[model samples]
Target chain A: MVSVAFKKNLKEKYGIEFNNEDLLERAFTHSSYANEHHGKHNYEKLEFLGDAVLELAISDYLYRNYPKLNEGQLTRMRSNIVRTEGFSEFAKEVGFQNEIYLGNGEEKSGARNRKTLLEDVFEAFNGALFLDQGMSAVQRFLKQTVYPLIDEGDFDASRDYKTELQEKLQINGAIDIKYEVIAEDESVPTFTVQLLVNNQKVATGTGRNKKAAEQQAAAKALKK
Target chain B: MVSVAFKKNLKEKYGIEFNNEDLLERAFTHSSYANEHHGKHNYEKLEFLGDAVLELAISDYLYRNYPKLNEGQLTRMRSNIVRTEGFSEFAKEVGFQNEIYLGNGEEKSGARNRKTLLEDVFEAFNGALFLDQGMSAVQRFLKQTVYPLIDEGDFDASRDYKTELQEKLQINGAIDIKYEVIAEDESVPTFTVQLLVNNQKVATGTGRNKKAAEQQAAAKALKK
Candidate 1:
């Protein structure tokens, strides 16, 4: 049986209440508990659903808010926001640690603090929310929990060299740039990219990999 | 310069008009063309961005539509919908072959029907749409093009043993099932799963891999 106090606390924290107690229970029930019980309940499937839901919510939010942001920027931002650390923090903020049901071994080990566990729990919660309240409610929950993080722009900007190169090329009237992995070795594989102007190869670069080579090639071509 | 007749034809067929003619042109211009042009224009980066956008869009639509679908189901469905064959079909339906601007060599080699080219062009188109009209337009276009195929259940049903096992377990009130990859070898790895009831291993199975073994174990447990 779910504690009324726990439900009430969750509602106060997330600004939502669960209509289906089973869904909430499923969210908190760790795989270890299901293992010990011989698999009567677990959060694995829910975790999977929650992952997709979280990605969609974050992607949708990013897409709408940053119209000028390219796809690469949006992808990196989504990855940063949905990473284990971010989800764990979100789980703790929403009071999942206190409310979760864990097996004896897991409880003793402080599995609640594990990044993977917390992230899974966070996803499971989203799955539960979707089951209990519906997609709209889950979207609302996601917007509340994740939208603020996106607005903060805490994602790493250095990770988007590809987007940067594309934008730079577009601005320079060199609209065509290609990255191809022509060779791979044990070390850094060589990537070859040829920059074109009116269907002519103006610049070619070789690097440790396709991305690096492309960036170097683009940078070189830009100078011309 | 974009052909006026082609632009009108695209609008009539796709129900979308190009806001930025350059974006559309860029979408159609392949890396080979850009490489031949000396890197003045290319669709490779756009293809990359479009791939992500397409994935997110399809994932979002599936999440919203399938309330009862667990994460695995949604993932399998998404994969089925976005696989090479599906993309090629979508490309054909959209008349992409007619619109895409290919290099002379690629054109002669029938790159238009090539799965790789089709997938890339589809992704590039997605990138172009996202750039031209933002997320809403991309989302709408994806929903119209992809969602219906999913709704019609245009995927192999046999690929979802995990889901079937879960449903059976749920129905039978045998909630405890656990899968573990016990051993791996050069040829076929062995997996072990125990189906428990009140902390007892009621049934156990072995298979080529953990997932297959778990499913078999679940199947055996369900029979009891």
Candidate 2:
């Protein structure tokens, strides 16, 4: 059973209050725990629901807020936000390591601090919140947590523009993709790269290195 | 541009009326068309949004309607609904092939009826509807189109229970998966199969043939 004090603590710390405390409890209850305690609900079903809920929330936010971002960029940004490590970090910040219930065996095996478990719990928590209070409440809660991280550009560093460009161009059928270094400034040590799709010059960029220049050109092509 | 008569026809045929005609037009405008016509917007961004919108709607429907279904079943069911062929069927029913805008070359190449394009158009239409109204509006549209098909078991035939069970059990780590014919009744022309996950007899089934019995056993294990 989840304590009244724990519920109060959630409200105090995270601005979240659940009317049905059982869902909140279920959100933190791992399948291992449920297997050990017969007939108890686990977080798996809730995690499934939460995954979709989070997708829509993130998609809507990115679509509206990032008008300049293309579909590929928006997709990449959403993936970064919802990835295992990112959600695990959110769970850690919420102290789920202390709150989560697991089987004695699983707990002994360090499941409490496991990244995948923490990520599942975070999603399950959001799923519970959505069921209890609806989408707007979940959005508000995200505003307090994930939205700030998004605003801080926490999800931007992992984009591989070159790969994205290749995928987009190849979606219809296989086509020739080339990134050619056109010129180099010896004094400044800068390389200029041109991106060609089927030998048609699409975009150009200059950077301190060849890879960076190629990536920059690909990024430009994606924007085009 | 989307004509007033086309809008009226949509309202009469499918109970859909768009407040923003421009968004409706954009939803049907292919990238090829947009590229051919300078400054014209395409359905790519809207298709991205619509894809997430559809995912959440199908997920919510499955989660609420299938109380006995586990997360694995729910995911598989959702995939069947949102797959290219399924969405393309919906697009065909909506007469999108006639309404869609394409470039000269694309139209000449018969892209208007292309399965993937139709699926993208179906998603883009829903996305535009979501932006024009809200999630409720999109839900209402699906009630008229996709939801009935789901209720009719249109998405049920493609289930591979064996693959699903394997995926679920293997998510934690790889384990030995075996299906053995435990018994055979030649006179009755039936076989009994037992599914063993890591040497544990999890579930059993009987069917007219070995393959059928194995699938049934796998399905039973998944339900467990």
Candidate 3:
């Protein structure tokens, strides 16, 4: 059951007051809970609508905000943010962990803490908001939350590859990795970088800049 | 260059008049054309934004109009419509093929008829419309075009599997294909169907109804 305190907190924190409180409740209700509760509506439909809304909002934000970035770059950045892991992080930040209603079995299994469930609830929340308000209100909610994160370069895909590779490779122990400029073409201003893991050639990447080439190399290496 | 007649036609046909004609022109301008013409902007960015807009619009339409459908069914139907082949058909219907500006090379290669290009142009056009007017206008346009097609069950995923399977298996000549009820559980009200091709069982599926079971069986057979 949704608490009055939770409703008050939403109204105060985000200036959101739901006319249809049931919709809000539906957003937080897991399928497991619905199954146990005799065909009560779950968050799945809301999640579906919310997913689309998020995609469009993010795409619009990236398109309007990042003027210099090409479509491909903007696309990569949007993809980085509009994913399960990314949404889970946002859900966590919004304190959704405690808000979600789970079945006794799911609660026993600690399903509330699961990233996929968190992601779904996040989307479901947005969908409910969209239904109650509209796209502008949803955009306002995102402005308070997601837009700032984007401004902080939290979901920058360009910087992500190299950082992800380093984090992943370093998890085992301290490991030596090098990205060396193997070739430079002044005509096209292209730089080719060779990536080495423990002094062994792993991947080579070519791009318009050194950072881009290194990121590409890291991306290729990660695939391996 | 975008023709005045094109603008007039849009106004006459769809009652759509762009405040920024350049944006409309940009939507129709191909990247290849932009490269040849000294980087004078292209449709890629618009296409990216348009893709999202279309997704959300379709999602909203499906959610509101098809209340009985589960999230999974709605998702599958959306996927069927929001694909390259599907968009290309819509683009052709909207007469986008002639409106697109391609490079000399692309034009010589007969790229105007290419499904990929048509799809891109379709997205670009929607994106441009979104930028010019907004979601409501795009919804109106889709109501005039796409919504009708959807009403006709043109992209129905449930019926699609059986039809697609039959079409694929019967490309050369008429082939004997049959759907047999293998099992029925009255307690659970479950129907199990076996898909047979050339008098040999290819796949089996279970569902709530015989039609659903047949579709599932066909889907499995198609996978094989």
C-alpha lDDT values of all predictions: 0.68, 0.83, 0.86
The sequence of per-residue lDDT tens digits that candidate 1 reaches over residues B1-224 is 55777678668756789789888988888777777777457776577567666766776677667867766677787776666356655665666767777778988999878877877888888878887886678877766666665665555344444567677668867676555544545233344666565566767777543444665676676666
lDDT digits (tens) for residues B34-132 of candidate 3 = 999985899999999999999999999999999999999999999978972667766766678888888899999999999899888888999999999
Highest TM-score, which number?
Answer: 3
Best of the two (1, 2) by lDDT: 2
Top-lDDT structure, candidate number: 3
Ranked candidates, highest lDDT first:
3, 2, 1
Q: Given candidate 1, what's the lDDT at residue B178?
A: 54
Model 2: CAPRI class? medium
**CAPRI-style grade of the A/B interface in model 3:** medium
TM-score (C-alpha) between model 2 and the true structure = 0.70
Best by DockQ, which number?
3
lDDT of candidate 3 over A5-80, digit per residue (tens): 7778778988999989899999999999999998699999999999999999989989999999998899998887
Number of residue pairs clashing in candidate 2, backbone atoms closer than 3 angstroms, sequence gap of 3 or more or interchain: 0
* lDDT comparing candidate 1 with the true structure: 0.68
TM-score evaluated only on chain B, model 3: 0.73
